[model samples]
Target chain A: LAKTTQPISMDSYEGQEVNITCSHNNIATNDYITWYQQFPSQGPRFIIQGYKTKVTNEVASLFIPADRKSSTLSLPRVSLSDTAVYYCLVAHGAGGFKTIFGAGTRLFVKA
Target chain B: DVKVTQSSRYLVKRTGEKVFLECVQDMDHENMFWYRQDPGLGLRLIYFSYDVKMKEKGDIPEGYSVSREKKERFSLILESASTNQTSMYLCASILAGEDSNEQYFGPGTRLTVT
Candidate 1:
């Protein structure tokens, strides 16, 4: 399992774009980067995932560098409701028991 | 939509009492996992089951055990609950052989042992 390191917290204003970066120096070839969002007292929700390059979805975008050592999760036009803890996980494509979630980045969306 | 349901949203138990946490998923995912989340420890895996009657210990499995009697249901058992076992327990399931490692999580159960 590739361990992920992220900032403890980040602050952004409403309508501003937020980017959270994760560092995984020991990422493997088969490892994929996945991001999840969790609100207070709720389970983490899947946001976006990518192996390499850029992958965009309606919710967020995942950008992976060529080295695969780091990835960025970009949230566009953040709102107050988007304030949550964001987790970046690096695991194999078929990750089952090998999945690990570290202390996530707490994003505070200010009005 | 993938839906995972836990037996309880909150539970209170006394020390030395037996505790059971049940999780059920409607997607029939083959892999079910039990994890405990704390203030600073994030999420630590206790046990995971890949198939019926098959189980594997994760990072933290000392005070926990799991049973998967059916494909959709997995149960976590704490033989004798202690005060330290008080934490939020989360259950998740993922389909096997899927290209994406998307996991569906249930509303966590906040267990308080006094």
Candidate 2:
């Protein structure tokens, strides 16, 4: 499993876009970048995933450069409800492989 | 939607008591995992099962055990509950075949050992 690095916390205002970046310099070819959002007292939910380039979903967009060393999770027009810890993980697949969640980026969305 | 259901949302147990945590998934997924979350530690894997009756220890499996008798159900057992073992436990399941992008998580169970 590849280790990921992210900021401990970030502050964003409502209606503003927020981007959280994760770095995994030694990402393997088979690995994919996945982001999860976790609210207080709730299990982490899947936000977006990408293998390369860009992948967009209803909630967020993932941008992975060609180097695959790092990726960014972009949340457009954020709201106060989006205040939560965002986690980035690198995995080959979600089988029996254990996911290592680092100290996630805590996003505080203020109105 | 894939739903992973844990038997309990909250539990309280005394020291040295036997505790059982049950997890069931309705999507017929081949993989199920158990993790415990604590402050400053994030989430730590306790155990995982890839197939029926097959189990694997995860990052922090000491003082814990798991049983997978069927494909849809996975159980985490604590032979002797300790106060240090108090934490929030989460259960998750993922599809077995290709394109297993994300794992679905269940509403966690907060266990309190006294």
Q: After superposition, how far is residue B5 of candidate 2 from its true place, in Å?
A: 1.0
Highest TM-score model number: 1
- Residue-level lDDT of model 2, residues A1-111, one tens digit each, is 788999989999999999999999978888888899999988899888888999998899999999999999999999999999998988875352777777789999998
Specify the highest-DockQ model's number.
1
Return the TM-score for candidate 2, rounded to 2 decimals. 0.96
lDDT of 2: 0.90
Tens digits of lDDT, candidate 1, A1-111: 789999999999999999999999999888888899999898888898899999999999999989999999999999999999999998777754578898999999999
* TM-score for each of the candidates: 0.98, 0.96
Cα DockQ of the candidate 2 complex = 0.67
